[model samples]
Target: MVTSIASVCLSGGLTDKIHACAAAGFDGIEIMDSDLTVAHESPEEIRALCERLGLRIDMLQPFRDAEGVDEDLFADTLRRAREKFRTAQRLGTDLILVCSNAATATVDDDAVTARQLGELADLAAEHGIRLAYEALAWGRFVNDYRHAWRLVQLADRPNLGTCLDSFHILSRGHDPAAIEEIDGEKIFFLQLADAPDLNMDVLSWSRHHRLFPGEGSFDLVTFLTHVLRAGYTGPLSLEVFNDTFRQTDTGRTAAHARRSLTWLADRVATTDSHDDRRIPEAQCPHAVDFVEISGADLSTADHMLEQLGFTFRGSHHRKPVRLWTLGTARLVLDEQDKHETPHLSGIGLSVDDSDRASARAEALGAPPAFRRTHTGDHELRAVASPDGTQVYWNDQPAETWTEEFTGGDDGDSSGAVVDHINLSYPWQDFDEAVLFSTSVLGLDAQASSEVPGPRGLVRSQVMRSPDGVVRVPLNLAPPTAPTPPRHVAISCQDVIGVAERARARGLQFLAVPANYYDDLAARFALDTAFVDRLRRLDLLYDRDDDGEFIHFYTPTLGDVFLELVERRGHYDGYGAPNAPVRLAAQRPAS
Candidate 1:
């Protein structure tokens, strides 16, 4: 689960919200609709910025009150849904959040609400979107995962799904066992959060006193175990709506989040290792696609990962450098010079053993960057990556560990696994880059290919995990063409899925030329209807002998533009053959 967190759920709209979440150790972020609008940042701009920050927008949120509304209100809601859908499209996302109807809900009949939700589901499907209906604790119609799940079942639309919220689920006195009966696929989003158990209502408690996982009393371990047992494979977001968290130091808060999530993860691993009376690993078919790394500098990044004793995985073959998969999670290092003022190139890592994993990495020569000790508390070490990135590992006290490290935090975003990363290098030093990656970082070199360009050939290499779960492309600038650095591709099971979700979140995409699709139809022999659909979506296409892949290109921002991709099979290579075609399309008319 790429640790995702709700936007407003964290702090505020400032980069502080991002910084806190990152610092709190989240892998992806869920931008509330108002966050983008409030910041006066365009969806396209946010998409670009997140891409730059190395974060994924798990879901565009607060598509509240979609069901059980009057006709006029429903129309207005649907209109907003369409706008959010387009935002999702531009953001390169696939899930949109639809909280249960609140204020404007004119109707209270669950049956009628379910029917209306079903109609909305069809509408979402038309845009290739999934509506994850969250049952808020205060919601009138549905306020629990079971109730929401029942509603989803009633809707019966493929694109209609439920969101499992840790706060709401556990706060209502629901046990993890509630997850046992649900269909995993129908649970599109799982939100995990922890709060200091109090006498107040769970919703109010969540908004004021929620802590990171392991820091609270909720049985998140049981909850997450149940979620995993139910085979609910999706991103686990840390959606804490806490007032104190808003004022907490960004870096400290992020570190706490990392530690909390890591503790939960360790517990999950142990639970999975054991055969519990309630669930068995063999019976628990669901696996975490990826864990999240939210906050910390490159050194702290190193700290967050090394403390967990995670091994370095491979990185991408194109664009500015980013690496993935150390300690069972993905670490995204923010490489932008803008934040370089704080010199804050950040890190997020998912690890098997949050503590030992990070410690071992430090032993393997990670650079120590920060330290803090209170009373008899042992000094905590933050480390820097070989590239001078900062990160820290979780060292939550043993008791807190039991409380927070429960494989369940209630934030909301999905698509937890890392899809891919793009890296770039100088043509001259490309060989050294490959060597450093394959040997020092412990990744296997997959293949090298020549990208034919107008001037000459651009050579590159693909590196991946031995199991093939990670794929990164290393691209060296051709000596002849002076193009700048950029990230060129993203991996996903469903491009249309990402597109629809991105549309909902207000993401922006670069326009692709129609001629590209015409060429695709002529060359690939794809069904005309499919080609037309791709063209309309502005999605590009390519193929390897194993299968096909889709991609998109944008003008350079910093060193690279972003690529959103859907791979159909073992087509492991970058869609190299399509390189010339895409470049031609993206290049200004000369």
Candidate 2:
């Protein structure tokens, strides 16, 4: 299956967009009319560049509001279409896309629509151009793909066929099963986009909130499967209209789009059981082996860890790194990256097979991250995530890597294990991070929520493995905000005990305001004594029908923080209700 992305999906001039698409390994691209109109290069020059870059201009898109108008308007539409058709010939593209009119279409008659489309097809044929008609989700008359196909059938022109867009169809909640009812040969193009479930009108939803495959709430696999079942074999192209992608780096956006199509096409291939393009199956992470903090000096972090009940495990034999462990939770401190403050720089995940996982990452275009390994040590095989964080995968438990740290207390009773990792990303990096968690690590993305914070609303989405052994919450920080601190949440057997011990060790926790306790009491109707104890220890609390959650946070140290959490009676949440209080209490890089 050849992969392509629309020029509108990326940012830059046409040359830059084409180069990024080619470098990102896309086989083709859809040249939007707007991109072409604004580019300094002529159509012939753009075509020559794409040829040089080994990219095919799949289609010239999209001629909008081309049909279903009065005789006067229809004449003007044809003249405009003729000019675009001439442009398509120069661009060396045979295909042109026409969108159903969302404005100025007074005629609701299918016969009129079909006749107008047929006339437009005749004009396109004069230039040897084939037209693919698509139904915009908010089109005046032909708003559904089924309706668009009916119009195509009525047109009965060889050069005219229907183009199916996943967003247009899925956003309207139309039945995708009807897609198979159309003739395969008549389906000329397919555009794919995934979007979160939004409550606004379709036009607004489409222009601002489209996401790539596997990053949103759409069932694109089933949608694509239906298209395949109908025998549509054209290139799989992406037409996302995300505001973030438009503003992000051109190369990065193009690569991210390519990865999404790869992931989607691979899934469709697996389900359809054909070898068009093979993507390695995901290697679901089994456990978080360890998280590493790196800086010029990590003495402050080291002290914070000890106060949180982590036992210092000593230094590595061959490198300037040390480890601390509390029960199954482990942290590795590296005295490096001298230019930056202490930060959560890397994470090691225990998977069933490291080699297979690394292969999957490579196939998805993740850049390989490297670290030196001395003789008789585990090779530090890793990949850099979209946000520059290094992700290391190992087949063995973290203790295998911890073996380098020779001297440590073996029998600690801290009763703590890594519950989840909270990573805050810039606005542009959020969707890519979500896709990374889904495609690379095989984690299931849960429903996302927004928490009000001091700066703005924080968008939170969690990606977790099947057995719930590994969880990573991806948070979308506000646009104007600075880089948010990343924290490691450790689930303990007893939260009050842990907080008391840390307090006894003279560690300053992020203080919770008194109003939080009042709200908790009002919300849950908890016992006064339990509420008093929680308030005294600065602990935040929440409860659902399933169980209760209690957690506390440490003050931010450099760009990192620590969280101690305790779950009672099968609670699965991350104490989301307490997030606002935590946000208000957190200092701004003090």
Candidate 3:
């Protein structure tokens, strides 16, 4: 399918947006009228630039409040349409998007709206331009696609057809199955956007909170399936209006948008019986093989790992990297990168077929990551995520890499495994990271929650594999705070025992406030002795109807930290209710 994006979805000037879209592999663009009007280049020059970049100006967007107006207002609207038609001609595009009137429509009658649209269509036909009427979710009169489609049929002009925006149709809870009933020829253009469900004004939500497909809660797969069933073969354009996307780097945002379309097309093709062969089948990883941290000095990290009962599994035979293990948990510390601070830099996932996973990631626009390997080392296929984290896919045993360690697993096993990895992203990269986790890694994004932080709210989303073997809890801290440190949480059968052992080994755990224990005792009605034991060990406790959770944290090590957790019964949460207290404890004493 041909992919396109609206110029308004990205940051920067019209020229920058065009170049970014082209570089990101978009086949066409919906040039917002304001973007073109404000460009330094003339329309002809802009058109030439798009042509040179191998991009088509698919549509000139947003001639708003054009129909269902008074007679005099209709005359003025017609003049505005004529001006837009001239602009469209110069921009080398034939279609202009006319959003159903949101304001200034005195005549709400459909007959009048249809007649006025017909006249506008006749005028557009005279200029050899087409008008794609879109029903805004908050339109003054025509707020539904069906309503807009009826008007388009009533107008009955070849130059006029309906533009179905996924946001408008889906956000208003309109039945998209009806779209299949409409003639494909009458459906002029399609704009797609996904959004998180929010209880807010529809107009505000549409304009500010829309996310790219696969990044939000919208059922875009089913949405696109219906559209494809209708036999509509137009460019699948993205028209997201996100506050974050508007301020991010234009090229990066454009690339992220392009990946969304590629992912959506693949999903639609796979879900339906379509013969499109662009994307490969998704490879869901079975388990996390290892987590790699890199730094200039890892002495402190080494000490902490030892205190937490992780046995040193020896350094790589060739590289300056050391492996530590506790049961199934593997932590690789790479001292090869001497310039970087301690950070969780890479993750290795065990999949049935590493090559297939790598291929799928590359197909979805992930950049392949290069790693130097010795003759004895296992060659891992890796890809760099949007935030520069390397994700590696490995075979189930990964013996090639595991056997390279010389120590031969001599140290005591702690009986702990990686429960989850907490990764923090800047506000700008949060959504992109979500998409990457879903589309490239084949993880499912669960419902996101906002945890209270000292500075502000921290949005957390958990992306996990189907069998719950691999879980990545993504956190987005408020921009005002310093970037949140990434952490790895290891789960033990007895966290109390592990905490005591670590304390005896002289590892300083993050102190919990006494008031926190008092509140927990009141909240969960825990036995006083249990609460006292938790407080004494600096542990946090949380429980739900299903089960209970107990966890504690280590002091931050540069930009990384560690957590030991114990989950009882069926407890699936990450002790979210205690996050504020944990944050307070992690904060430096004011």
Across 419-529, the per-residue lDDT of candidate 1 in tens digits comes to 555566655335434433432233466646777766567667776656555555777667667653445344555777666555454444567767777777778778988
The candidate scoring highest on TM-score is 3
| TM-score quality measure for candidate 2 | 0.97
Q: Name the lDDT value of residue 415 in candidate 3.
A: 67
For residues 348-384, write the lDDT of model 3, one tens digit per residue: 9988888888889888889999999877678899999
Model 3 stretches astray by more than 4 angstroms: 411-414
Q: How far is candidate 1 from the true structure (C-alpha RMSD, Å)?
A: 27.2
Clashing pairs in 3: none
**What are the Cα lDDT values of the candidates?**
0.61, 0.91, 0.90
Tell me which of candidates 2 and 3 scores higher on TM-score. Answer: 3
**Quick one: RMSD of model 3?**
1.3
Instruction: Please give the TM-score that candidate 3 achieves against the real structure.
Output: 0.98
Query: For every model shown, what is its TM-score relative to the native structure?
Result: 0.48, 0.97, 0.98
Candidate 2 or 1, higher TM-score: 2
lDDT of 2 by residue, 1-590 (tens): 77889999998788899999999999999999999989999999999999998999999998999888999999999999999999999999999999999998999899998999999999999999999999999999889999999999999999999999999999999999999999999999999999999899999999999999999889999999999999998899999999999999999998898889888877878887867667778889888888988999889988888888888888898888989988888898999687888889999898888898999899988889988888888786799999888999999766677778876767387668899999999899999999998988789999999999888999999999999989999999889876578999999899899999999999989988898889888998889999999999999998999998999999887888989999999899999988888777774656
